[model samples]
Every structure is written in C-alpha cells, then in structure tokens.
Target: MDPGEPDPEPGRIEVLRRRLAQRHGERLFAEGALGPRRDLAGVLAYVLALLVHGVTVALVVAGLLLVVLGWGQGALPVIGGLLLGFAVVLRPRFGRLPDDTPVLRRAEAPQLFALIDEVAAVAGTTGVDAVVVAADANASVTTYGIRQRRMLHIGLGYWEILTPQQRIALLGHELGHFANGDTRRTAVIWNALHSLALWHYFLAPVPEPDLVERITNWVMTPPRWAVYGLLHLLDQLTLRSTQRAEYLADEASARVGSTDAAAELMDRMLVLDSVEVALQRESVIAQTKGGAGTRRETEQGLWERLAARVESVSEREYERLRRVSVLRGHSADATHPPTHLRRRRVSEGEQWQAAVRYDEERAHAIAAELAAARDRVARVVISDTAC
Candidate 1:
C-alpha cells in the first residue's frame, strides 16, 4: 500500500482480520486496549536496580581517582569498584516495547490458511487475531489481549525479500506471541517500566548523598574518552534490550517453523539498506584504514560479509529497501538487534519460545487503551507520507 492512502476503520480492519485469524476454528483475539497492572513489581525492581547501579558506580569511580591520584591507597580500587558497579548497572539500558500502533489485516493470499493453521497448533491457540505490518521504520512484534493484536513490523527492506511462504512463516512467529501471551504478558510490566526508564532517560545527576560530581566532572573533562565509553555502554544496553526481544521473536518463530527460516529473515533484514549496519559499517571501516588500498580492503570485507548474509536474497531486493530512506538522510541508533546476532540465535533455537501464561489482570486491563494505538497506526501513516 502507498503509505499515503487513508486507512479504513481499525475495527473494520479487524473484521477482515477475523477472517484471517479465525481460520480453523482458532480462538482468535480482537482486543487492543492495555492490560492491567502486574509489571509494577518488575518496574519497581528495575528502578531499584538503576538506583543501586548509579550509586555504586559513582563510589567506585571516586575510589579509583583517589588511589590513582594518591589521595588514598587501598581505598582506591574499593571506591572505583563501587563506581564501576553502579556504572555497570546503570549503564545497561532496558525497556518494554513502547506503546505503538499495530494494524490487523487478513492475508490476501489464499495459502495463508495452512500457515496459520500450523502455527495455531504449535501455539496451542486458535487464530493470531491479526497480521500486523509496522506502518513505520521500526521492526517489532507485540501482542495485546486474549488472541492479541499480533503486530509484526518489517523494515521496507525486509518486505522486499521473501516468497509468500516466508512472510507467512514470519507471521506464524507473531502468532507465537499470542500463544506465548503467557510469557509476553508476564514481561509486560518489566517491559513497561523498562520502556518508561528509557522514555525518561537522563543523567540528572546522582542524589546529593551519592554525588560523583567531582570525579565525574574530572573524568568527563578534557574531552574525556570515558564519557564516550559511557555513551557506548548505554547504546550497547539498548541494543541488548532489542536483541532480547528478537531472541524472543525468533524462538517463537522456530517453534512453529524451522530455525533456518527465522534466521534467514533476520539476516536479510539487517543489511537491507540498514544504514546503521551496512553503510555505517562501511564508512567506519573505510575511515579506520584511511588509505585507498586499505579502504578498499575494509569495504570489501564489509561488502563480502553483507553479501554472504543475504546471498539467498538479491541485491535488487535490497536496492528496493534503500528506497525507504531515499527521501531521508542516514538515521542513527537502530532500535533492533544486529541481523547477524538475530540470525545466529534463531538458527540455534533460542530459549524464549517456550509457552508462558499471560497475566490476565495485567493484559486484559490494558486491552482497551491498547486498541487506541492500533487505531492510530491504521490512521497516522497517511500523514507520515508527507513527512
């Protein structure tokens, strides 16, 4: 669909979805509102963790500076250790899937039924409730309510690859989230708080009692590499959160289809005009060498790696993916796991696929509000066309 076209009612779209979701007498879900609260404890725990991580890291940095500067001898490592501890904890980013739009629609493909049926059996659930394609750039799969609105986002690059079977197989994994609603719902609060933590990310400074102001200032002064290191650490943590989510999705996919399918899909998507993965890496390797011969060699290595990862898919397909950002400039900070990592874990069969129970109180309560975001997704992309 041209992102410019106005969408039909999501509730109406839900009707088309019902046909796709309920093939085979499957217990299809249709809810979109937010679930009830259960992640409170999980969120609280993480908050406590951040507090602890921050305080401890500050102390350790202080201790290290004291010793290195000879302000104190034995206490330096101890203090540094405290600061490092907090740094380690606070530095790692975590969050739940942000509340976003999820569009539910039917498979125009007649063959979609078999794939749905197969996954339904694996998921031990009826219908997937919806087949979601992210209206935007991010790639994610999230389920809300009893049959869940199974939202699966693909980068424009990813949609370019794949036979119909591949798409259905990918969708099957989203169905896994519905079946594994148990696990997903359980993680919701952990996710919500994590999401909140990220949404409100800041270096607002340590509380007075644990201030690392003096040391933090010194370390960050003089164009400190430590500041850069800390930023990298945060990015790494964010990447990990996304990676974990992919692990969960891969595991879900493998349970219904072959690990190879999931792995291939992920690998293909990673390099497909992923400026972060493909262009950015190429640029970095080139700069690292800074000589014509060396630059060529570095780019060649990156090219070969990217080419091998997507050998099954054609360059023309990726070229199509490049179209996604043709009107835009390079983006920074990819929110998904690296394609290579996603491929490896899926191929190996991750632990995240197993069935877990959804917390009804939490999931059900959130369903109504959740649907609002779905409605927005069904509507907003029309305007983004201009953007």
Candidate 2:
C-alpha cells in the first residue's frame, strides 16, 4: 500500500505482522533508528545533552569558586558571592513531574491492573507500579521512584468515550514508550533542558524578597541569559527527535493492537476532545438553569446522555469541527505529534488478516469494575474543594 493511501484489503493484518517481523530481523530499532536521519538525530540529542550539562556544571563550579574567592576578599564580597552561589545551587531546573493525579490501587480495581499487566508484558517492560485516573482527556505512562517505577494514568474523561479496541490501542501506545526505551533515553536529557529553561525564572533580575537577593538577582542575570540561549538551541535540535519518538510509539501501538484501530482511536480522540467542549458548555448552562444543588441530578445520567449526544453528531458536522480543531496541525513544542500524521503513519502499514479486535464486553467490564473509584475521582476533579 502507498504511504498516503488507506489499506482496505482483508490481509492488512498479515501484512503488518510481516513488516513488524522484518523490522525486528533487521534490528531497525536496536539503537532507536526508524531511519538513518533519526539515528543521527538521536546521537546529536545525547551529544547536545552532554554539552548542556557540562555548561551547567561549569556554572555551578564557577559560582562555588566565586564564593570562595569572595570570602578571601572581604565581608561584603563574601555575602554577595555566597548568596549568588546558593541561588545557582538551589535553583530547581527539572519540570514538575506528573504526580498530582489520584491513584487507583489494585485492590480497588484488579481488572484494570490485569489489563495493564497484559499490555506491559507485550511491551516487554515490568508491570506498572500504579494506575492513576485524572480529569483529562488523555492517558499516559509516567515514572516515579529511584527505580523509575512506571505509573499508568487513565484519563476518565477520555475513558468514558473510547471503545474497548481504542482503550487497548491507547494503553499499548503508552507502554510502547516503555518498551522502546523512549522514557529512559529522554528522561535525563529532557529534564536537563527543562531545568536550563527554568534557571531563567530563578535568576531573572526581578524584585526580590530581601535586599541581598535583589542584589544577587543583578549578578545572576548573565547566567540566566546563558541558560535560556542554550535551552533554545537544544530545543531546536531535539524537536525532530521527540517527534520521531512519538511516531515510534504510535508504531508500537499498531504492533500491539492493529493499525486501523490505532488510527480510529486517534481520529476519535480528536472528535471527542472537541465534543467535550460542547458538553462542558451544556453542563454550565444546566448549572445556571437548575442551580448548584441540582448538579447531582445533572450528573446522574451524564455519560449515557452525553454518549448519545456525541453519537448523534453527524459525520459532516464532525469533519467540519475537526477542520478547525486544535488537532488539525502539528504543535511546535508538544510531546506528541499531530493526530493526522500519527493516524497516517499507523495506517500506512501492509494489509493482513487476523487483525486484533476489542469488543464492548471487556470495555464495560473494566469500566464497571472501576466505577466506584472513578466516582470518587470524578467528584474530586469536577467539584469545588471548598464546599
């Protein structure tokens, strides 16, 4: 099949299986290379990371040395240098890791854990340490602990909309990140880049709480500029590498599930995301009409009602909405690639028979099993904590 064209043949699954086998035999992903250019980019990303970290070390050492030298000079110099050194030392650099979401324990939902284990085993990784649910319309796998314990986060908003097949595809794609080493490779490098960018915020020459810090801010401005400049350079070089990683993860989804299912999931996610905006608007309107006390009444039959509302949307209307949707084009700095590109990449694989399928029964079973936890989470997510 042509790269741009869809595969309609009954043997599409068999074709994909052969392609995956060929890729394995050739070890195309051994060093994380889907193409020669991507391989070169991967090497460049590591080299860039090392160079950036070296500069950070130099800055820290320089700060410490200044502290020592200033101490030898005089009290005023010592105070200034010591304070500046501390700022450099203590300024946080890494992005805030994903940890605020509510946790879902195995005891509360063994069925969900079972599904996660199945996907993780297929992805060739140790099972996840936790399953979390959040208010978002996205699902992801994150790391925690010194051992980098994997945690799976299922966005209940998104979960309510997906079919069984799409759920598997989503989990498979996330686990694929673990399986393909994307998480480990980018963990330190991306964190370093984020830290570099963040140092600017810490050292920015803004008004400070104390007189000493105000003075320290003036001295630290130069380092702040340097960090930001390096951050820009690194982001430019690594953008393609990040995009490639996402593509590989999508390919992994295709391998674990099916290409058609993955593509459909991507397409549906965009539609559902758009539809959710309308749903929220309606929810607000209902709140205004009925009052805050009536919220429970509104939420009682929410999903079934909303699901029907979504299903009632005409295809032409959906296509029209999607044309102007945020999912239309690639985001410049997003962690994932554009939905269209991702859908296309997965769909481009060869046609085969025996494609995997997920029915409504499993989807309902998983949802029913986790319904109680989902309710608690939904309350926390959708309501005011003050009340």
Candidate 3:
C-alpha cells in the first residue's frame, strides 16, 4: 500500500485489540488529560495573544476611522470587542494553549536518558541531545540535517498509552525520522512560489454563493484566500513528499525493530481507527467502513510470530503497551501525530519471525528486572510523605 493511503484491513483490529487486552489492560484516554504537547500550548498562547492583540488594535484603528465617519468614541469599545470575537473564527489560529502536560526530559524519572541511549543503540543512530515526553500521546522525529536543527519530540500520550515494547517500537520510528531527516523546510522555496502564485491568481475567498456578490467577495478577500488556497494546494503537491518520507521512516523502523513489530503497531492503529470510526458511525456523523467478516487476514502475525517479532520489548512490555494502547479521542485537538497511523506506516509489514531469533531466556530476565523496577518506583511514589 502507498504510505498514507488508507486500506483498512478486515477483522485485523478486533483480533489485535483482543490480543492486547488479554496481555495488557486497554489504552486509557481520559478527557482533559495530557495528550497534546506543551510547545503547542505555549505556541497557541503566544500566537493567539498576538492575533487577539492585533485584532484589538485593528479594531481600535477601525473604530477610530468610524469616529471620523461620525460614530461616537462611546460606540467604539463595543464595536472593537465584537470585532475581536469575530476574528476568532478567522484563519486557523496557530496559537491556542495546547493541552497542558509536563516536559518528559525534565521529569523526575532518572531512567529517561538511559532509555534514550538504549533506543539510539537499537535504532543504529546517535542519541538526540535531549529527550522529552510531552503531555500528549504523540511522538515526532524532526530534523532538517547538517547544521540545520534536528530534534525528536514524543508526546506523553504515547508514554502513557504504550507498553515498553511498543514504546521501543515507537522510539525506533521517531529515531528513524531523525536518521532519515524528515524535515521538509527545504520545500519552503517551492511553497513560497506556490503561495506567490496563489496570491496573484486564486487568492480570493469565494465571492459568490451565486452571482455578482460572490465574485465581488472573491475579489475582496485576498489575505484570507491566499492563506487558505495555498494550504489546500500544498496538500495536493506536497502529499508525495510526505508519502515518500513516511515510507522511508517505515523502512527505518523495520531495520531497527523486527518487521513484525512494525506490523503489530500498524494493526494496533488499524484497530484504533476501526473503533473510532465505529463510534463516529453511531454518533450520527455516520462515517464508518462497512463490510466486516469477509476480509482475509493477510497482513502478518498469528501469536507465535508476534512473540518473536516483539522481542526488543519484554512480553511484560507488550502487555503494558497493549493495555494502554486502547487510547481514545480524535486526533483533531492533538499536537502530536497519531501513534495509530505512524506505527502502522512504520510497520513495513513482511513476515519477521524468521529473523527475530527470540530469546525466551532474556525475556525472563528483563521481566524480573522490570518488575523490580516497578516495585521500586512504586515505593518511591508511596514513601513520599510530602503530598
């Protein structure tokens, strides 16, 4: 399947969910919980603050102009306030206090750096300068490369939702992004040309619902249509860049983790989309994939395969991620990319068990060690007499 293209597999999700539920609990997505990143939160605050301030200032300017037309200064305040509210619905505000969550790198957890280093080794890439877990569940590998800035940001949502193995799988994907250098900042030049064309050509809002007013409106709204049209056009032109990048990332994931690990993650996301679509289907938007049961399970995995493929993460880790993978909510409000989608694309599915060479002995060792670590963390949390 082309990367990013939708090819919903049949019966795969239900089975995966069952498999995960049996091993781990369901993924929990509590409302108002931290799933979006803090940068977005800060970005929104700063950006919207500027937009609002701009609109407020603009309204003051507009109102003063109105005063020259004989509208009293007394009426200006009310007019300015209403204009500010109206501006809220204008072009997508890049600033909104993203969901609140603490930074992971700065968290009290001592194991973060070691975990990052371990991931870098597994991924065959140098470790990042720092690592952080955002309040959100999303994770990203961002870098433009060579003297350009490169950084990986993982949302707390993934940390919360994934088991250690899944987390390992996820980290592989992001590091792949860093390793692959997914930043398209270089595309800015082309994008600028596109925007210039849009500004001169189609950069006008729909002027006519019908007739002359629509034409007039289209002619009048330059900034709005310029921004909106450029965005729409980029989705079409840049999609190939995006798809290819995603494919590369998936390949990176396969190299770092077993192909099957990637496959399981994909299946996990397929289940998430299925469940979400199921809910939306019932919720009246009614957008759900029809036709279940007749589909064949061609993707990969059938229990034993999953065991060998997921060896990087302990069985315990799989159980933990599966338990939490039952994450819910739309990705609309998300600052982080959807794990369901990223993991699936990165799976690059091809039977991987043949190559995994599982160590049942090591699994046992890691399980015992991790169990002890959990107990120690619990003790630390509990012994804190200071609330």
Candidate 4:
C-alpha cells in the first residue's frame, strides 16, 4: 500500500469486514461440528458486552455523586445535571411492536398457535406470545417490552411460498434463537449494543447547511468516529458467536422439521429475489384491474396465486440460484454466515428425523386462521405498489 493512498470507502471496508467474519466463522464451525463449548473469542465478546453495561452504570453513579458533593458549586451542579440528562436521554429502550403490524392472537388462531407450540417444544423453547405477519420475505423471533414477551414475525411473502414442513422448519429455526447461546440477544448485551448504536446515531454528523451547523458537526466528528470504532470493535468480537448461533438455529430447524425440509428451506432462501419479483408482479396486476371491487377480488386470491407461482419455479431455476449463491457467497445478511455454508452444514450432520410432524389437515386449519392476515398483507402490498 502507498503511504499517500486514501483509505478504502466505507462500502469497501464493510465488504472486507464481512469477508473476514465469514472466514472466522468457517474456521470455527469446520465440517458442521457442534461442540458443547464456548471459544475464547466468544467469552471475550460476552465479557466486553458486560463491561459496556457496567460503564453505563458507573456513569450514572458518578453523575449522582457529583450532584451531592457539589451542592453549592455552580459549575459542578451544571456538569452533574448534564451528565444525568445525557444518561436519561441515551437510556436503553425496549422497543415496541409496530402498530401497523398484523398480529394474530391465540384465540383467533388456535390451530396456528398449536403448531407453533409443538415446534417450540421440539426446538427446546417456549411458545411465542403473539404472531405477527408482514410483507417482507423474511421471518424472525424477538422479545418486546420490559416483560420480554416473545413474538414471532412471519413474512407472508416468504410464508405463502413454503411447504408445510418448510414452515415448521422456519418456526423451529426462529424459536431456536431462544435456546441457542446467542449472546447478542441477551438483555444485557442487546441493551448495551442498542445504547451504543443510539449514541453513534446521535453523534453522527448531519449535512452542514450553515456555518453554525458546520461548526457543530466539526466539533462532533471526533466523538462520532470514536463511537463508530467502538461499535465495530464490539461487532468484530461477537461476529463468530453470532454466526455460530445461526448454525445452531439450523440444527434446531432440522431436529423439528427433518434435515431434508431444513435443507429445502435454505434452497428457498437462495431464490427469495425471485419470490419478491413474483410478489411485485402480483401487486402490479391487482392494481391494473379496472375498479376497487375487481382489485379487492384479485387481492383475495393473491396468496394462492403467489403460492402457485413459487411452486412453478423449475428445478433448473433452483439449481441456477444455488450456483449463484455459491459464487456470490450469499448470506441472509451481513450478520449471517453464508447461505451455502449453512445449507452444507445442515446436511452434513447425522440426518435428523423430525420430532414433530405436519399434515395437510393441520396445514389447512392454520391457513384458515391466517386468512385475515393474508388479506391485510396483500392490501398493504398493493397499496405500496400503487403509491
């Protein structure tokens, strides 16, 4: 490297980061071996996360001490107050579920809830408190509020395309997050990371539209970069553990949904782009219909049509997608390990027979329960596409 050469762009740096993370992950989980041990790197990451939270607590304590000791001093009281206010403003938050999310209660979707419960039990986790449907081609399990009530978010765009067994695999994988030793998901670590992220966001420089704003940004730049570096360090420390959690989640998926089904789910993930395209096409077609009544009628069968389109995806196309995934080192996201690695790992282990099973009758009953959510999601998709 030349001394005078500029540093890589942020996008290039991120790509390099991901590549390094992936290499570390591949080395950690060689040949799909699942050992019951935490590596030194994972332990260090966990300790660092704890230390971050401890620092926050220390800050609060120091602020209080300053307020008490400097009761009569003008400058000291103001400094103490500023510190207290900063702590309050940057406090860790338990995020709320979006109001627009189409949530399904157990009472309204007993059959669906039952299936999820069975999958949860098989995956060694408890049943979710609520199930929400969305329009993206993804699914996840998360906790909400101080109570940490569990919630499952299923993307209709993805769910509508999967086989019944694949759906069970998806549920098992998500519920597995609870059982997996995913340090990042733990309250202490998650909140610490969240607070740091918030600090980074607040400290970041905005567009300098005026001299005063420019000065403020210039003053803020050093602290912003400091926070950015810290965040990246923490992320690097936890990268391997996070990736390991994903593989463990895949194992859970296989345990409850069978290895074949779980592997098929990975293949499905590889072609999610095609799924998105089909969904957009459907949305556009619905919008093109002459009247609101016609569009609504089309929306009602949207899921069925989408399902058929996905089902119609040929083996040749699937193979092509798999090859593409391999070539591109495709992953669900930067946080996840590569798709091909996950797929290979799940299949390499002793083929897991499903502990839980799904039948057409049960599948139908679950779909019946999700009917309202499907319609609502369809409407949302169409509305967004029209706009």
Model 2 lDDT per residue over 1-387, tens place: 112333244342234333333333223323344653345546666787777666666666766766666666757456656556745664434323345556766777777787777766765666677887765566777776656666787776676676677677788788877766552245667666655655666666766448887888778878877776666556555555555566777776766667766776776665554545645654665557666656666556555555666567677765654454333342212444555555655776643221334556666777787777566654543353221
- Per-model C-alpha lDDT, please? 0.42, 0.60, 0.41, 0.81
RMSD of each: 19.5, 9.9, 16.1, 5.3
- TM-score winner between candidates 3 and 4: 4
lDDT of 3 by residue, 1-387 (tens): 112343344353233323332221112111112132222333333343344345435655665555565455577656755555543433222212223322223133335545555666666676664343342324665433344444556543233334445555666667755554322323332333333333434444463367776877766686665454443443333323333344455555565556766656544443333333322223222112222221112111111222333334555654454444435311211122234444444443443432222245544544443343333322322222220
Which has the higher TM-score value, candidate number 2 or candidate number 4? Answer: 4
TM-score computed on alpha carbons, candidate 2? 0.71
Top candidate (lDDT) = 4
Q: Which lDDT tens digits does candidate 1 get at residues 127-202? A: 5444444433334455555433444454322432443334444655556545543322334333433433432343
Model 2, residue 17: C-alpha shift (Å): 34
Minimum summed lDDT over a 10-residue window in model 2 is located at 1-10
Runs of candidate 2 with Cα error greater than 4 angstroms are: 1-33, 36-40, 50-101, 183-185, 202-225, 272-279, 286-293, 321-333, 352-361, 384-387
